[model samples]
Target: MPFSTLGLSEPLLKALADLKYSEPTAIQKKAIPVILSGKNLVAAAQTGTGKTASFVLPMLEKLNTERKLRGKRIRALVLTPTRELAVQVEQSIRDYGQYLNLSSMAMYGGTDIEPQRQKLIWGVDIVVATPGRLLDMAHQRALHFDELEVLVLDEADRMLDMGFIEDINKIIERLPLERQNLLFSATISDDVRALSKRTFSNATEISIGNNNASKPKIDQWLITVDKGNKSALLSHLIIEHQWQQALIFIETKHGAAKLVSQLEKRGISAESIHGGRTQAMREQVLNDFKAGKIKFLVATGIASRGLDIGELTRVVNYDLPDQVDDYIHRIGRTGRAGASGEAVSFVAKDNFRNLCAIESRLGHVIKRKEFEGFPVKKVVPLSILNYVPKNKR
Candidate 1:
């Protein structure tokens, strides 16, 4: 369905056209109407499904139609899990609401707080922030939600997992009792359901796909190699396949840094991003990678949450993630917006358990390919066989 039919303002529709968005995504089709109805909602959809635009569009429409709320307080608040996500959401708001008079800012850690304090004092119509930093602003009286008409939790599951439950509760306590509350997550677990019960009042629930399903457009494959040969295998594949741009995932910040060094030695330019890097460094690296200035971006689990790149066709797992859901999120960096992509993993003996857990959770065995020099020496079966097919063994 077209966004115009969703009751958005002419300005928003114009902005959408400028952004080259011709149709509303599934989540947007279901969510925009619900949000425009001024009711509480709980939404579930996988990554890269236009979840950001779903809420941003409706919220902007509401702001355009409704009379300005009282005070210099925040009227719309969006809580995200990480600094990167906070920045991403704010950018979307700006892009979608450019024609409107709405004002929005992103507040998160790893940046100077004084400027944020000044912006809040000057006033803003919307604020997208991480839970902890928002709470800090609240405690300092730099932000107030007494006039808030809408509250949104993007990636609710990730916020809860990151131990933001208490912060969220505190923030909610300060919001006006009568307001629209929306919770959006990739997966709805028991804990997320319980949180929704506390946060929303008789909210409508909408889900776009199978709760734990991976994107069907992503082609997943794995290569079994020894721990010592993972770096070599990754370098060989990138060089041989002439991979110009790929998002690589590692288990730790140090591992990401090390992988960048190894790839550099192979005459491939790469950059690393992690929690330890300054916000400026992370943004620069991400921008460069997006611009094709850097072909490879090695990141820790920090990138799995809300990183989005245009035409990101390849994701390589130099180190398999321990959590099956994390594995899904990692590869989800590619195959976004209905585009076909490839997810390649380097599975060592130590990652056998992780591989089994992932395949079992996925309910299908990932096809394994062995290269000439990198032979699969040790066939560590899943408890002597589970994810590995009998024919392959």
Candidate 2:
């Protein structure tokens, strides 16, 4: 449905129109009105489903009116799991609130605290931050949530997975108990449920395909090859497909770096982003990838959740992620917003267990493709789940 029917104000609608966001995604359709009504909400939405806009649009609409802030008080706060996500969500706020008078900032660590402190001198209307950095600001008396009107925990599941529950609780404790609360997650695990129950009061729950088997827009497939020849197979597939841009997921920082070098050696320009790189470098790399300056980006799991790349047509799993959930997120980088996309994986024999888990999660086997000159020396046996040995049985 058109965004105009979603109760968004004219200014927000104008901003969305400027960005050519004509239609609202499923999450936006469900979550926006509830947020506009100032009710507590718990939404289960996956990445790449335009979930960012679901919250940002309504938030800007809610904070549309001006309120004088004290020295270091914020009207709304959004807590994200990663620095990348923090930056991206803040950017979305800015983009959607362009015509409004509200001000916002993305607060995160890995940089000088003094600059962040200085920005807090005159509090922003909205602040998107990571839990640890936000707590640091609060401790140093650079931020005050006493008058905060809205509190949003974006990607709550990921935050819990990264062991940020304590920090999250600490931050939540400092906020006004009467404020509106909103929690959005890709998966509503037991931990996420507990957090919601602890903090939220009769929240309106919205779940859109949280437990679905698969995304039909994404065509997932795999190629079996030896570990040693996986890189060569990736190069072959890229050259054969003539793919202009694709996010390649690897297992480690070192592996990401090695894959970039290997791709460069094959005359394909590429870049890498991981924990080892400085925050500035990671941000710049993300910008380049999004801007199409870098056609191939080799990233570890750090890039899985928060690096928002739009209309990405393809992704390559240089190494399958250990968790089936991660496999879904890695491929989620593509096929966003109902766009047709491709996900290819280089699977070695040793990765059989991971493959089985991923396929089991999808409720089907991934289509297998054999590349010329990339014959499998050790064929991966077909996945046979629920098999118990005679003795065990």
Candidate 3:
């Protein structure tokens, strides 16, 4: 159904139209109505399923109808796992709430704390923050949630994985007990469920897909090569396929930087973002990539979650992630918003265990193909083979 049928206001519908969001995804359809009802909600949907917009739209609608003053108190608070994700969510709020008069700000580390404190003093209706920075601000008494009407824990699973449960609990304890609480996660494991139960009261729970499920619109491909030749394979695929833009993930910050340097030597426009760089550098690289100024972006797992790029068509795994969940997050970067895309991974002998774990998580074998010039020096593990359909093998 169209967004209009979901009870969003004209301004939000207009914003969605301008943004070309014609219809809601399954998660959006299920979660929006429940969220709009002012009930606590715990939603589990895979990344790239428009989970951001599901909660964002309803929260904007709620804020629009409220008549509260917003000078000293944050009316809505969104907590994210990383600075990049916090900025991304803030951008979505600005884009989707473009027509509204709401004021929003993103608070994260790697920036001057004084400027953020000043922004809070100037006042904002919504605050999107990373747990650490928000905790810092709270300790300094720079922000308060006395008037908070809604609280969102975006990427709840990731926050827990990142060891932010104590900070999250501390933040929650400061908020008024009667406010709406919403928790959204790509995967709702036992820990996530227990956290939700402890925080939410009689919440509506919605699981749109199985945990770590790969997006169907993504055509996943695997190529086996020698460990040292991954860069060659990546460059070959990008040039041969005429890929205009590709988000490439590596295993280390140093690896990301090295790959970008190699790509540049090959006359490719590439950039890298990882924990080693300051937050400003990462933000600038992400902006350039989104604007199509940089065709190739080499990133560590830091870019995996909550990094949304419009019409991103390619995601290459220069190095396989350590966790299957991360593999899903990396591939989910492409094929977003119902768009078809491709995910190609350069697998070496050392990455076999990661590949096997990923295949097992998805309950199927990824399509494996040998590139014309790149010959496989390693064997595809029998475990991965076991998950392959008999006809395909």
Candidate 4:
């Protein structure tokens, strides 16, 4: 169904048209009407399903038709887990609300607080922030939640995983008791469900796609290589494909930095981003990579959630994540917005168990293909034989 038939205001419909959004995604179609009806909602949707617009567009419409705040008080508060996500949501709000008089700003740590304080002082219609920094500002009397009309927890599962539950609770306590709440998560874990119970009363629930939906558009394949030659194989593949842009995921911050250095030594324009880097640096690296100034971006789990890079051609898993769901999120970086893309993973002998676990969770084995020159022998190493496949043994 088209977004125009969703009972949206004429201005919002016009804004969506200008953005060239011809159709409503499943999540958008299900959630928009419920949200517009002024009901609290718990939405489960995977990344790249246009979940951002499901909430942003409806919220913008509500704000446009409702009363405005009188002072420097925030009316809508969006809490995200990372600085990148906060900036991303704020930008969407600005884009959707451009036709209205609404104002928005993003605040997070790893930067000077003075400028953020100034932005709060000047007033904004919506504030997108990380919990820690927002709490600090609230405690210092630099911000107020008395006028809050809606509270949104974007990436709610990630917030719980990052141990931000206490911060989230504190922020909730500061807000008025009668405000509306919306929770959005890629996957609804037990912890997230419990949090939703406390945050929303009589909430409507919506799920966009299947729990194990396969992004058929993404061409997925695995390459088995020796642990020592993994980096060499990656460098060779990048050069061989002549890919203009690729986002590579590693398991650790240290690993990301080391890989970036290795790629740079081979004359590849690359940069690394992770939790250890300052927010400003992370933003710069992401911007540069998206703009094609850098050919490759190496990141850890930080880039796996709520980050949308348009038309990403390929995603490389340099090292497998411990959790099966993370593997799904890592490869989801590509094949976004109806664009066909590719995902390649390097699985070494030591990571065979992880590969098996991933296959079990996916309920199907991922096809393995060997590169012509970079062949891996079928025999299993004796020491790690127990972890290898029975057929290989």
Q: Which candidate comes out best when scored by TM-score?
A: 1
TM-score (all chains, Cα) for each model: 0.67, 0.66, 0.65, 0.63
Candidate 4 regions exceeding 4 Å error are 1-38, 42-75, 79-111, 118-126, 130-149, 153-179, 183-201, 205-216, 303-306, 375-393
Q: Give one digit per residue, the lDDT tens place, for model 3 in 69-143.
A: 645578999999888888999999999999998989999876899988988885688999998789899899888
Error of 2 at 303 (Å): 4.8
Per-candidate Cα RMSD to the true structure, in Å, reads 6.7, 7.1, 7.4, 7.1
Clashing pairs in 3: none
Clashes of each: 0, 0, 0, 0
Best-to-worst ranking by TM-score = 1, 2, 3, 4
Q: Write the per-residue lDDT of candidate 1 for residues 151-183, one digit (tens) a residue.
A: 999988767645466678898888999899999
Q: Which is the better candidate, 1 or 2, if ranked by TM-score? A: 1
Per-residue lDDT of candidate 2, residues 1-393 (tens digit) = 799899988998899889998889998999999999999999998888888898888888988885788878899999998888999999898888989999888999768989888888888899999987899899989988887999999988667655566788899889898888999987776668989999878999999875343233888998888999988888887898788999898889999989999999999999999989887898898889888899999988864435667788998888888877677667766775457889999888899999998887776778898877877889998886435455653
Q: lDDT of each model, Cα atoms only?
A: 0.84, 0.84, 0.83, 0.81
